[model samples]
Target: MTMSQQANDTSRNPGWTSTALSQLSSVVRGASPRPAGDPKYFNGDFIPWLTVAALTNIPESKTIVFETAGKLTEAGAQFSRTLTPGTVIIANSGATLGVAKILGIRCCANDGIAALLDLCSDVDARYIVYQINSQTDRLRTVVATGNGQPNLNTGLIGAIEIDLPCKDEQSAIADALTDADALIDSLEQLLAKKRQIKQGAMQELLTGKRRLPGFDGAWSFEELRNLVQTPVTDGPHTTPVFVDSGVPFLSVNNLVGNRIDLTDLRFITREDDQIFAKKCKPQRGDVLLGKAASVGKVAIVEEDFDFNIWSPIALIRAGSSVVSKFLYYQLQSRSVLTQIAVLTNSSSQGNIGMGDIEKLQITVPCVDEQSAIAQVLSDMDADIAAVDDRLTKARAMKQAMAQVLLTGRVRLV
Candidate 1:
């Protein structure tokens, strides 16, 4: 059976009832003021203005949305539909179609969104929000308006069916999901805090501003080219034909945040790999920097692999003076990133060249201090990774809970 059909079957519990959404609430398509994007229509502070983009900040299980990106003047508000707090809003057009949020304050929304107001007392708004969000894929498949570009109308949203439990069960399901949301939010906040601490540590430790205890030596400044054993080099200038499975061919997209991600790597023939490796063969200790689209992202090669990089990725192998991990962190420092931004800005295609890479300068300390600083930062990274893993698991569990609890397959009350 299809997902929606399975959902319908699951709702046939002892006390649950299946109902069309129109029976529980009224759906109103939002409007936009004439002369769109005019400064006169906004910022006059008559009512908060909402667009599909602003709904992104609303937490998944949240039921109220107070602030918005723009405010409508009285004239603008006259041309728009004013939705009161507690109204459920859904984006009905464009890429944001099926995205939904609850209005936390009285607001006016643009034409791209629809508001569900005057909800019946039997329905818990949060439960409805979760139900609608979980069925976004199904909703998109059943759109009643537009051809190539899908759009949702009040008729489509209102006619959509939902399985409902009694009021208490609805509240119980919402509370359970809300508790799960709280856990996810807590993990997210903790991750942000850890990242902030790591940034501060990088700012202090990478620079000689905050020296490690028991070590006090003046740091030296050197051009990046002098610190590396090989002359700073990039992969082949021309693109090679991709094969089904052979040696991995990496590009700027493969460099994912401080590491080379081989998950979606394209492969070239071994003969092509041999040709590219002749120029810049990446080893375990070399530092890889993206010079094109994802400019300045640095990753240290952690394992031995017979992989070749694209022309946009520059490879740097540290010499005797600097450690590989230290060089990686140095490239990630704000100072180097700022310089990279300046260099890329000067170029037409927003890419830095090998020449640009060689001209870049970095501050370095003695080998011992470099290792110590890298260790401190690496430990922090490990801690953050652990929390991130937990957050991922929590989100998965919440989704599973929603599928069962919201469907009445597992009764909570």
Candidate 2:
């Protein structure tokens, strides 16, 4: 099978897709960073190691951690039957489920993740790794045992099967998909550099360290009410009618620390946004600030998607007082977040209100300064956006390659 033929889902490969099944077989949990253990375990040169912590905010990749002290010695390696290099490791439980990484270096992980070993035999490991990653979520939804904890056991993993094809085809698929991954990683690095450049611009312009060519003026505190047009509104004091599918209901949880992940936005309906837009309909540049669950997390509603409100989320309008982009970054700055946290009502889940946000003071430069500052930051933001777009395309290319190659639709060497 060639790449083109394998890509067609309706073709013969549709049935089994030439795959295999397996599991971590043995589970190794993470170490307690503290507590009496041999100092040698942690005191050595850093090595690649993984924990669920590694999965928290990164995209799919190998070598998540840079520094590693907790590692298996030669003796430990012998006893543990660790998977060889190039094996895929994945998170099995908790907030992150089914996230996997191809191990780039010889390393081990704790309980937060399980290492799927023994890929060369019944299953071509790389191909099997792809199959496992693509299926785990669906596998997870269907498997049932206890609500106390959700997990995928070895038996569950082995039973989960894929369309079987010739091993040569499987190898071909893995190889093609790998090329796509390589392209994506390269683009991501470029994007990272663009963002770093922007951040440097922000630190200089906003701090007065480097002033752009033009007029200069002293910064002063401007009262928000007088300078601002849109005031912040607390989301529905009452609970929203949440359906699995509805208009995306915005909340602190929905707003990640620095940006809005449109992919994971919770839903409400046209009716809900209508019922709530008086307080929650956010515009393109409107800043979506978190008041309840977290004090100062801020994201902008850039998409045209209709969304409504939930507790702890406050919608702010642009009254022409503060630059939306400027305010967004300011709120995200370390100082503002720390300030908000300190002033917020502490609870199992943190909550703050519109009034509290309004009361917080901020320094304002003139409109010209605001525009100039925002321009520099906006350039940086644009650079970041461009880089992120490349990363997205890279991942998508890989996903497509996987669908084709793994299914025997494509053949490599």
Candidate 3:
């Protein structure tokens, strides 16, 4: 019977066959030039060099990489392994082990990377990459259960088992997944652009450079103390004994983006929460600032929820002079951030004292304009957030699709 007929045989579960990667391609480890950072090897233009970072640092959907940080000289190229365009490479060592990326340019890889070359006609390179990506955990497990240094050498990589289909089906599966990846990449790019636009808008709106219509108020530079209803205070100075469940305890780590993140939240007893609440209770319209460790990070508490923060957080209540949302944005302004950075003491841990936080300068406009400016920026934030949600869902969908498609459980042909 023909190979295609065999692939279509019902007895073989519609042509899906299990085989080792060694049967389909040549798996080889890359090389690194000696005496790291030598100018003779690194500062030349013979070829673009690939490092594990080049693959591991990119976003999940960014499977194709166009460039590298360093280039290799003719001497360096002699020491490194040269990879052509469209070649598939995987990081073979360190924490990023098994991470796969496709080269979009002619380059050479360092010893930390392994390239899959000379793939057979029945296999699609992208299909193999998707398969590798899906089994990243398995690849890491291979290193974890091994004898030598934690590394995924060529032998281990080649010995990996793959569920293979016929050539046509492999290409079809790869094409469908590639299209999904493209959608994800586009969404990621759009989200990045939206963030950049919001940042630019912040630069102009928060400063006096751009003014909203129907407002012609002179902006004034005021100390943070003058604009707050209460003296800035912090959470408990001492860490409390954490309970299995009760009031959520937070720290500088909870300040994610412009909002508080309660994921992996620790808990303190209700008795402890009541005690901390008496000294510093975060209410709606209050601003939370990271005063230690993460130093300039800030977030606004938008809900009237019962959660207590650690000593690393500073609580601020806005007075009638400024809007709370406005204060939140102003604290994140470039000028204010610069001031905070300058005053941050870095003896043991980066700490911005309450006194220093109160004394920092901020540019503020009339209350009416402050509200209007804050509204405009908030709308932009909402837009970016919506796109971000879509991007996240798209990524999850791609993973699900890969699980089914790569396993030949769902046939695209």
TM-scores vs. true structure, each candidate:
0.92, 0.69, 0.93
Stretches > 4 Å off in candidate 2: 1-58, 63-69, 72-79, 86-104, 107-124, 143-148, 151-164, 223-226, 229-288, 299-325, 345-349, 410-413
In angstroms, give how far residue 200 of model 3 lies from its true place. Answer: 0.8
Q: Write the per-residue lDDT of candidate 2 for residues 274-381, one digit (tens) a residue.
A: 877776566677777777656677888666755665767777665675777776666665455666787674545566666667765566677777777877777777
**Candidate 3, 1-413: lDDT as tens digits:** 33244345434556778667788889999999998899889979888988887666677787788989879999999888888988888889876788888889999899999988988877888888887888788778754357766788788888777778888888898898899999999999999999999889999999989888888878999999999999999999997999999999999999998789988799999999999989998889999999998988899988889898999999999999999999999999999999998888543556889999999898999999999999998999999999999988998898889978886668888
lDDT of each: 0.86, 0.61, 0.87
Ranking by lDDT: 3, 1, 2
Using alpha carbons, what is the TM-score of model 3?
Answer: 0.93
In model 1, state the lDDT of residue 70: 80
Error of 1 at 250 (Å): 1.7
